[model samples]
Each structure stands twice: as C-alpha cells, then as structure tokens.
Target: MNLLIAFLLTVLLMSGVWLWQRRSGRADWVDAFWAGSIGALAVFYAVFGDGAVEKRVLVALVAGTWSFRLTRHLAVRLAGHEQEDGRYQAMREHWGERAQFWLFVFFMGQALIAWLFSLPAWVVANDPSPAMNVWVILGVVVWFVSLAGESLADRQLSAFRRDPANRGKVCQVGLWRYSRHPNYFFEWLHWFSYPLIAMGAPFQWLAWLGPVLMLLFLYRVTGIPYTEKQSLKSRGDAYREYQRTTSAFIPWPPKD
Candidate 1:
C-alpha cells in the first residue's frame, strides 16, 4: 500500500515535470526533482512509518539533509537556464521528434530510481527499536562525514570554477587533487550509513543495494564516464594529466 502510494506519487510528480519541460524545454529540473523526491520519501517514511522515534528522526535528518544540499546545489546550477543539461540536450538531439516521449520515460524512470534508492531509509524509518543504539550513532557519524566531505568538494570545485583565470584548467585544488571525483566518492559513501542505520530491521540486507547500485551507476552508467568524457573534451590535456595523477574514485595523494 505504501509502496504503491509512493510510486504513484512519484509518477505523478514526474508527469507534471514532463509537462513543464514540454512547455519550457528546460530539462535541468529533473536533477532537482530527483534529489527532492528522495528527501520527500525519507520524510514521508519517517512521519508515517511505525519505526522507533529515534530511528525515524535520525533517518529523516540524514536523508533530508542530503536531499536539501544536493537539490539546492542543482537548483543553483539550473537557475536562469532555459537550456537543458548537456546530457539531456544530447538525448534531444539524438531522438529528434521522438525526444519528448523518451524523455517522459526517462523522467518516470528517475522517480523509480529515487524510490529504489530510498529502500534503506524506508527500512530504517520502519524499525521498531525503542532506543538509539551504536548502529544508529555510527550511521549518523558516517552520514556526517560523507555530507561534509561532499560539501567541501563541491565548494572547492565551485570556487575553482568561479575564477575566470582558472577557465580551461582542470581543478587540482583541495579534494580534487586527491581524487578525480571526490564528490562521487563521498556520495557513494553516504549509502553506507543506511545499512548501519537499518541494522536489525527487516530486510536490512537490502541496504547494500543502494551502495552497490550507486557505485555501478557512478562508475559505468551516469557518472564518471560521461563526466570524464566532457572534461576531456573541455580541458583536453589538462584533464588527462589530472586523470593520470589522481585516483579515479578513492581519495589519496596524487601520483607523482
């Protein structure tokens, strides 16, 4: 019943966004929606679920915090642009007249993916434990570290971008110096919190799905490949050099 409701709501939300994209032709809103939907589902689960008060509150706090940060960052990047994200723009070009139909499908898929990723949050929020425990504290700690690390990486990259003199140069400052995608690494690490948070809950093992799927997505699907392709195109030899010296996902000192 709850699953049905969440899916229906997600589909509805995506449908509305698709209509808006049709009218405005800006598909960048999808990223914000994806982030916002995950937050919404976490809050929904926290409020309506029969979980222990401690578990519910903690899950909501962690999920909601991540959602807020990610969506806000995407919103700012999306602001003042009628242009769709480059990936979506490429899809538009490829699909031609069929773009709208395929994009509708894409948007709907995003909603499902968002919900799927929230399974750990759902389990945590539905836990019946009466008091906070070590697992809960550990989850919170991991969430904090992941969020802080990702946030710092974003800020450093943003600051680098804001400097006109840095244009065409690859970012090697701060976290970027250590990993080619510190932001992605931290984002992947965020999933580990849920397994810890959902400890002892029914289907707690399901929590592993989030991190595994995210790593696959980041490594092969929607993440590093496309990003590196674009970076290579833009920064040319600089990004290649950075790629050579920096760890691809994990943070470590740059290779000499």
Candidate 2:
C-alpha cells in the first residue's frame, strides 16, 4: 500500500508539473523533463529501496537502462519537432477552454500507468532474496533482448525517415519491414521479463496486469490506432500498402 501511495503521489506531482508547463506553452520542456524524471526515479529506487543488494542492484540496472534508452530515443525524435503528439493534441481539443485540466489528467494518468508497469521491479526489490538464480538470469536475458530489439527498431525507423530518398514513403526496410510497431511490440515483451523475475513473490502475478494493460493500450487504445490513423492521413496509399504487407505488432516475414 505504501508503494502504491508513493506511485500515486509521484504521478500527481508530475501531472501538476505537466499542467503548469502546458499552460505556459512549454510542452517541449515538459516532455524532456518527464523523460529525465523517469530516469531519476530509477536512481531513487536503487539508492533508497530497502532490499537485498543483489535485488536492488539488478532492479536499478535494468530499470535505468530501459528508462535511459527510451528517454534518449524520444528526445532525438522530438528534437526540432514543433508538433505536439496527436494523442495529447486530441486531449487538448477535448478540454476545450479547460485544456490545462485535461493535460493534467493525461500526463498524470501516464505517470500512474508507468508506476503500475514498474510494480514488479519494486516488489522484487522488496524481497529478501540475496542470491541470483535461474529466474534472474532469464529476466536479464529477456530484458537485454527486448531492449536491444526495441532500440534497433527505433534506429532503423529514424534512419529511414532521415533519408531524403525515402521522403513521403513508408519505411519497409530493416525491422520496420517485419512489424508496423516493432518498438511497441518489444516494449510489451520487455514487461513480461519483470514478472519472470518477480515470480513467487507475493502479489507478483498481478504484475501481469501491467503488460496486459499496455498491450491493450497499444492495440486498442492510444498507441497504434492513433498513430496509424495519422499515418494513413499523411501517407495515404503508401501507408495502406505497407499495412497490407506488414504485421501490426509482431515481427514476421512480410506477406509480400
């Protein structure tokens, strides 16, 4: 319960900050700050968690690596980009004249979701286990693979975007050729690694909810649906053709 409270408070505080920044027309700063804040929280958990050294250290290392990689990737993507994310922009519209209220809800909501997603790590760190075992080894391997796959997918997409010859064309090379949202797919896979580490710990099975929620969000809610709609609007026929040939979330050989 204490952990849940801590997560809620963190979310509320971050949401308030986001609302303030959005009202002040500082969305870029808000996004960057949120990324940095996530990295900082991983550090905080590492230093302050009252657990065995091995568990704390492992949680810190894996969480920090994931946070840092994601933050850096978003920073690069948003660099010199003036448009707000479509999801956020849609929220802004929904809020009408009270956009700040909705912005607060949106940002803070994600913070809470992030906290939930990270619960397994926190739970594992709270355990008294002193020795690394097979589960730990498996978790580490999954984390490494997921992290590498997601990062590589992002890099491939970014490189495609940067090529002048590929302007206005759908990216169908490298990882992008196999999965429409390879990065998101790998991110979801990464969460399962947490449960593998925390298995047998009290309430640890509940951690499955985190990844399940994330998968639903990506497939049915705020992720691929919105992004692909925007893509279709912008890319038209090219994106449609790519969609027909490419898998949505999972990586596989292209049908074509």
Candidate 3:
C-alpha cells in the first residue's frame, strides 16, 4: 500500500515538474525534484514502515540529510534562473523537434527511477532487528565516509570554479586531482551503505539495486559520459589530458 502510494506520488509530482519546467525552459529543475522526490519517498517509507523505532528514525535522518544536501546543491546551481544544465541542453538539441515529448518521457522515467532508488531506505526502515549489529554499524561508517568525501569533492570543485584564473582549466584540486569524478565515486559509494544497513532483512536484496543501478547509470548512462563530453567541449585538450592522467571513478594517485 505504501509502496503504491510512493510510486503514484512520484509520477504525479514529476509530471507537475515537467509542466513547470516546460514553462520555465529550465529542465534542470527535474534533477532537483528527482533528488528531492527520492529523499521524500525514503522519509515517507521510514516514517510509515513497521520497523524498529531506532532503525527507522536513523534511516529517516540519514536519508533526509543526504537528500537535503543534494537537493540544495542542485538548487543552488539553478539559482538566478540560469540556463538549463549542459546535459539537458545537449539532450534538447539532440532531440530537436520532438524534445518536449522526449523530455516528458524523460521526466516520467526519472519518477520511476526515484521510486526504485528509495527502496533501500524502505528496506532499512523496515528491518525487523531491534538491536544494532555489525551490518548497521558498518553501513553508518560507509555513509559517513561517503558523505564526507562527496562534500569535499563538491567543495573542491566549487572553490576551483570561484577563482577567475582557473576558468577553462580542469579542476585537479584536492580529490579532483586523484579522481576525475571523485564526486561520482562517492555518490556510488553512498548507495552501498543502504545494502549494508539492510543486510539481514528479508528484503535486503532490494537494497542492492541502489549501488548496482547507480554504477550502471554513472558509468554507462548519465554520469560520466555526459560530463566528460561537456568538459571536453568546454576545456578541449585540457580535459582530455586530465582524463588521460586521472582515474575516472576511483580516487587514486594520478598516473605519472
């Protein structure tokens, strides 16, 4: 029952967001709403699930904090009603005359994706275990490390962008110097925490979807390919050189 409602609510809200973006010409709003919807659905599950109070509450707080941080980050980028994200803009250009129709489809797809990703939170929130165990503790540790790493990556990128002298240059500062997409690596790492939290639950298998699907998306779909394409477009040879020397996903020393 709750799952059904979550799915319906996601589709409805994202449909509304589609209409809103259509009018504003800012498709990036969909990304913010998508992040928000997942968080909202995760919290909804955590609140309504019939699970141990401590576990449910912890899932709520952790998922909520992650959601809020991501949503706010995307929102800040959307401030001043700026142009659509380069990815979306490129998509629109590629889709051409049928862009609106495709965007509508894209928005609906995001709705489903958000609901799917929220399942980990649902599984964790509904864990029947009443006592803290190795899995839960491990999950929390993974979450902390991932959150800190991602935050640091974002800060490094933002600070790099802030310097006018760094304009048009690849961001090879802090974590960026190690991994070309350290933020993405950390985001993927964060998903594993959910499976860890849900380790012993009967529905624990569902939690695996978060990390598995996220990796697929990051590697083959939206994460790396688009960002790299855009970077190459903007930075040309500089980004190509960065790509040649830096690890694409994992944090590691630059290739000598």
Candidate 4:
C-alpha cells in the first residue's frame, strides 16, 4: 500500500540523516529532517491517494506549507553549522559513550513520528468528498492563526536574542509576554487543523492522532520539559520569574 511505502521511505531517509549526523556531529538537523519527512510523505499521499483531486491538492498545499515554514525556521538556526542545541548537547552528555547509539535510535524514532503525524494528511487525501465544507474552512482558518502566531513568537524570540542588550534576559516581547512557550503552544495548535480537516473522512478518527500526540509530546515529553530546563539553567531567576508570571502553554495575561 501507499502508506507502507511512505513509512519505509521515511525510515530509509532518516537512516541517511542519522548517518549524516554521525559524520557532522550535529543533531540539530534531526528536527529539520523530521519536519521535512512529514511534508514529503504528506505530498506523496496527496499525489497518489485514490481520492478527489481537489481535496488531495488542497491537503498537499496546506501540509507542504506547514512543513516548509517549520523546516526553514529550524534551518536558519543551523546557519554556520553553529554549536548543537543545548537540549541535544545535554542529551549527548547524558548518553556519553553511547551517545551515537542513542542518537541513532532517536533519529529513527523521529522518522516514525513523522510518519505518524502524516496520518491526518493521508486520511484527508483519501477522502472521496469533492466539496469543501465548513470543517475544511475551519481547519484552514485555524492553520492560518497557528502559523501566524508561531511565526510571530519565533521572530520575537530571535529578535530578543539578537539584541546584545537582551543577553541573559528572558524574552518577554510580543507573544512571549503572555506565554512562556508561545511557539510551542502555536505549534501544538497547528495539529488541531488536521483533525478538523479530516472531519467526515473515512478513518477520520486517525486524524485526532495529530493533535493528541502533539499535545502529549509538547506538554509532557519533548517540548516544555527540556526547554524549561535549559532556560532555567541559562537564564536562572529571570526565567523563573517569567515562568511565575506567564502561562506555560496558553496565551493569557501575565500574573501580577
């Protein structure tokens, strides 16, 4: 089946990525490849799925845009092949002598996750419905908001970090003023759009995996915990104060 082939291709490509990381000694590319692999699989499913051409094309465009934006954003950080991200550096330190082995496993896990996240796109592409419905429109709207908010958050953080005056300061500009991790929040919000888009499709329930899995990882596993730890380590009391005043995952007024 097309799904099986996509999954296999993802694993194959990520294996190559792992090898490249091993050679380059940079784990940052893992995130870029993860985003890119999902986009590739989404487009593949859209192009080859047995469904309405319009629906497939729409999903392809949407998913591709999401992937491109995220991947490019991540890629920018890798300019000059800068030092590895703190989180990954910490991971390498923790794993020590077995770092390469664990990183290989981590890269493969990302490949699997990329495929899993593509489920909504695959379902949407396979939907035979030719008409655009309220749900699809809603999904697009949510996608717009998520993309805009996330971009704003990233830009704000980048601008803050770029300023010599802001060094060692917690970013409290733009969206960051309200949410400690606005980018992560909006990234998580982006997953909801796929489920909305998948409404009424066969296997629509599978679409829920996007938002559900994203929330689980962002909240409990990969997103908040590491970022918070890194921030606390680097920013110390400033980050602690930000944490005290700002919502951890949602945009809201800061506490007094």
State residue 236's C-alpha deviation in candidate 1, in Å: 1.1
- Give lDDT for model 3: 0.90
lDDT tens digits, residues 1-256, model 4?
Answer: 9989999999999899889888887888889889988999999999899879978998898889999999999888876456887678989999999999998899889888999999999998999988789999999999999999998999999889899998888889889989999999999888888878878889999999998999999988989998899899999988988899999989999999
| Candidates 3 and 4 compared by lDDT, better number | 3
Q: What is the lDDT of residue 79 in candidate 2?
A: 70
After the best TM-score superposition of candidate 1, give how far the Cα of residue 208 lies from its true spot, in angstroms: 1.6
Cα lDDT tens digits for candidate 3, 1-256: 9999999999999999989988999888888899999899988988899888878987887788888989998899788556787778988999999999999999999999999999999998888887778888998999999989998899889989989999899999899999999999999999998888878886999999999999999999999998998899999999989989999999999997
State which candidate has the highest TM-score. 1
Better of 2 and 4 by TM-score: 4
Which stretches of candidate 4 lie above 4 Å from their native place? none
Residue pairs with backbone atoms closer than 3 Å in model 4 (clashes): none
Q: TM-score for model 4?
A: 0.97
For model 3, name the residue pairs that clash: none
